[model samples]
Target: MTRVVFAPDSFKGTIAAADAARVLAEAWASVDPGVSPVLRPMADGGEGTVAAFAAAVPGARRMPITVDGPAGHPVDTAWLLLPASDDAPDGTAVIDMASTSGIELLDELRPWDADSRGFGQAIAAALDHGVSRLVLGIGSSASTDGGTGMLRALGARFLDARGAETAPGARGLGDIASADLSALRPAPEVRVLTDVTNPLTGARGAAAVFGPQKGLTDPSDQQQTDAALERLARLLALDPAVPGSGAAGGVGAALIAWGGTLLPGAAEVAHLIGLADAIAAADAVVTGEGAYDGQSGDGKVPSFVASLAAASGVDAVLVAGLIAPDADLAPFTASASLTEVAGSPASALADTHRWLHEAGRRLALAMRGSGPASGS
Candidate 1:
């Protein structure tokens, strides 16, 4: 009887992390009835981050706010606030960038001219409500103005060479030559949760990795994004070369400049959930996400699980919707093996449950060194 643990992030539109794990366990039980499976639903400080943190800290409260979504529509955004303890008078609050500015909210790849000003507005509101400690999840954002829009919403004025406040769009970013934060206020404590280590500028920056996804596929769009990033980075006095600075459309740059400490998103989640401790007791651990590849190495779900499994001397296996052909799984191979869910990526994406069952049966067969009987 193998002691297995299933810790996986959501498969995006297919299934929630918890449900996915449950399905995997069901499939595993079909092949090996005695196998024990532990479930740990996870996220990477983007979507569903608030729920994850709330699970870790029950003292946290969920507050709703109407903020601008990817389509510039008002969305019922939520953030987590930790209740004050005896030592701390005010509570700690967390702002998920995805809640206010994620690409998932967009219906189609429309050219968005607006900046991240909406995010700043949301944070400021959280502060006004007596949150002394603020945690910002800086990934899955839609803007690329180096967080200038967020700063503007937070009371920092961005001015053009003509000494006029820039407009609240992409065009406005190009004219920004300076920024004034004297009128702004901030919480005593602020931290940014980032999943990547790319800098705020240059070839390895936001424009390179995430720009295309944001509908900035053309040269003109890329140049515009680059220009906006340049202006914002200069205004913030950031090196523009710091790792993780480009995350969340350069929200990482602004937050860091605003005194926000950056931490690995998956690591933070793992620590909160005692992932290492859980892995230490398991014989086999299963981990995965929507897609697994080199990008997963940067504090993504599977990579983090693999790391924990390694520390515990347990074997980890990755099951994903699609495994990139060129993906270097060696890092996960140290303690885990990668496996595709179905016949092809498209098929798996179409039917997650079917693929999960296939994966679970494979895992069971691998463990027992035998296949299941027909219809048994």
Candidate 2:
């Protein structure tokens, strides 16, 4: 029997990683019932990070709580509570920024007003539960608030020139004259998971590179936000030049200020979910994401999985909702794209699971024909 491992990330805004893996497994099984499919859903510290953990870890509990949303409204969200183990006697808490202060929570872009306070509040809840370790996934943020809102929720103070507290979101970043950590809660050991490598305050930094997507379209606004982040970095004694400092609209810097460590999201998640072990034992490995583009080569799930497969001398296959026209698929032994299978982007997205099912069938047939599947 052929052993196959399916490890895929979520198709952002459409399918969860776990769901995608399950559907793909079903499709593969339909083609070759004798094939043994091993499902291993993946994430990159974004919206589905906690869910990925929940699917991979046994006895992981969801701790629901209400907190301030990105738009300053109360929103119900939950964090994951992983039972204590020998490595961590007090247990572990897994939190995702996208669940609390993410862009998906907003009806419309709040730009300067959206904040990460909700994300911080979730962290506080975990701290209150007496967790010894924190695994924070900072992705899909709604604001470029320099993480002020998050720090504030953890009992830190961001004051203006007059010693008064500033406003919320990026709107307050420009006014922050000082920061006080005296009242901040003692933070547990934090491991920040993210794929971004942008710095905090330049053309390639958070504001200049990501601000426009968060509704900071005007060049002046981007510059101002960048300057504000620079000021915040100075006030907090942080090095803005560090890689990953700009993740989640500067929330990366904020977490670091709180004594957190940063690591690649894909690699970290892969390790946590035991992807390496699964891949090593599999006859073939399959991986994918929402879109395969130039950016996907940079620390994304597909590329990471492909590299792992290559290291293990195993054939790797890729399945994507949409493959960019110029994306290089050399890493994969075989590749299937929903866009090509469905004949149009809208059609593919309209019913993603159906298209994914077809993609899986095509991949299975292709692999069975060749000694090892070859990229199409």
> Against the true structure, whose lDDT is highest?
2
Candidate 2: stretches off by over 4 Å: 370-376
lDDT of 1: 0.74
The whole-model lDDT of each prediction reads: 0.74, 0.91
lDDT of 1 by residue, 1-376 (tens): 6788878877777777777778878877898899888777677777766666665565778888888765567888777787885544688777777778777776775444646866787898888887777777766777666787788778889898888987765556677888899987764678677778888777888877788878778877777777778778877888788888989878888888988888888887777656778789988887777777667776688888887888778887777766676656664432212234454556777777877777767766765668531111
Backbone steric clashes in candidate 2, count: 0
Q: Clashes per prediction?
A: 2, 0
**What would the per-residue lDDT of candidate 2 be over residues 1-376, giving only the tens digit for each residue?**
9999989999999899999988989988988899999888889899789988988888899999999999999999899999898877899999999999999999999889999999999999999999999999998999999899999999999999999999999999999998999999888889999999999889889999989989999999999999999999998899999899999999999888889999999999899878888899999988999899887998999999999999899999999988897888999888988888888889989999998888888898888883332223
lDDT of model 1, residue 254: 85
Model 1 misses residue 80 by how many Å?
2.1
